[model samples]
Target: MTDLILCGCGGKMGAAVRELASAREDCRIVAGVDLACQNSGLHFPVYRALSEVNEAADCIIDFSHPSTLPSILNYCRTHPGTSAILCTTGYSEEQTADIRDAAEELPLFYSRNMSLGINLLIELAKKAEAVLGDAFDVEILEMHHNQKVDAPSGTALMIADAVNEVRENNMKYAYDRHSQRKKREKNEIGMHSVRGGTIVGEHQIIFAGRHEMITLSHSAQSKELFASGAVNAALFMKGKGPGLYSMSDLI
Candidate 1:
């Protein structure tokens, strides 16, 4: 069985992970780290930081914010033979680089979206881009709950990047076209975001041609899908070497 220490245990995703892991036989949460420790109704002891946790964990599942990355890196450095599965988003370029660098020491799994369907959608979109080429115009729309701080969601960017990879990275992202009155550029991919009440998650990729149009979409009905993915990643991290892994590696 995999012993896990859950980060951001008070958050919605963290709570989901906690519930799912509790019901499973392969893994169990040994500890939790969160700033708001008082509100965490976890059966396991919750610490304000990872450093205070004394339980031996085989892997860490972090659903926390990007700002908590430093402490996690430090934990990995100090504690050898422990792997981590990072499920958080909204990381900057420098922070992403840090993650890669730390991966040189221990196994780390990171992904923008953990849903299996979303990853499949990414692959399908790439195939569509290859077949359609420049003849079709690509646009991506993403919707999340109002509390989400990031616009366009990281999954939207992941989809755009996958499509652009097929075009030799020649396509540029156009976040807002309302600033100037001009026709849509052929070399740009449009990105749009919507924030409203209780939207678990929704991503739609539209490809418009002269006479034919194809749209690919993935909607997350609940947070359990992501929690399952994260737990599976943690199990996969066991008995692995140092490297930066993603959903591509697990699936």
Candidate 2:
């Protein structure tokens, strides 16, 4: 069985992962790290910090915030051969670099969205951009819960990057059109964000051609989709060596 140390165990995603892991026989959560650090009836111990944890785990599954990145990195640095699956988003450029630096030593799996469908959507968007070429206008729309701090969801940016890769990274992203009165540029990709209610997540890629429009979309019905993906990622990291892994590597 894959022994996992769940970070941010008090949060929604952490709870979801904890509940799902409890039902699976292939993996088990040995300990949890959360700021709250309350027992809350969890079988495993929850610590206010990762440094205080004594459980020896095969991998660390972090659904925590970006601020928790340092502790996770330090824990992995001290514990050689331990892997980590990071499921958080909205990391800055420097924090992203830290993740890469950690990956050079231990196995690390990271993704903006853990949903398999979202990764598939990215691939589909890339293929559409390749087939439609410059004749089509590309636009991305993303919706999230009101509690989300980031304007454009990271998944939307991921889709845009995938599409840009198809065009040799020549595409420019337009986040807002209200500041400009000029027409849309042929090489620009429009990005829009919506926040309301408890939306799990939604992303749509629009490709507008001369007379037809094609839209590729993915809707997350529940948090279980991501939780389960994290569990699977933990399992996939069991025998993995030092390297950076992604959904593309899992899927």
Model 1 misplaced stretches (Cα beyond 4 Å): none
Worst 10 residues of 2 by lDDT: 73-82
The sequence of per-residue lDDT tens digits that candidate 1 reaches over residues 78-193 is 87878889889898889999999989987899999999999999999999999999999999999999999988798999999999999999999999888969999999999999
TM-score of 1: 0.97
Evaluate candidate 2 by giving its C-alpha RMSD to the native, one decimal. 1.1
> Which residue pairs come into collision in candidate 2?
none
Point out where model 2 deviates above 4 Å.
none
Best by TM-score: 1
Q: In model 1, what lDDT does residue 180 have?
A: 68
Q: The CA-based lDDT of model 2 is what?
A: 0.92
Report the lDDT tens digits of candidate 2 across residue range 160-242. Answer: 98999999999999998999999999999999999999998999999999999999999999999999999999999988899
TM-score of each: 0.97, 0.96
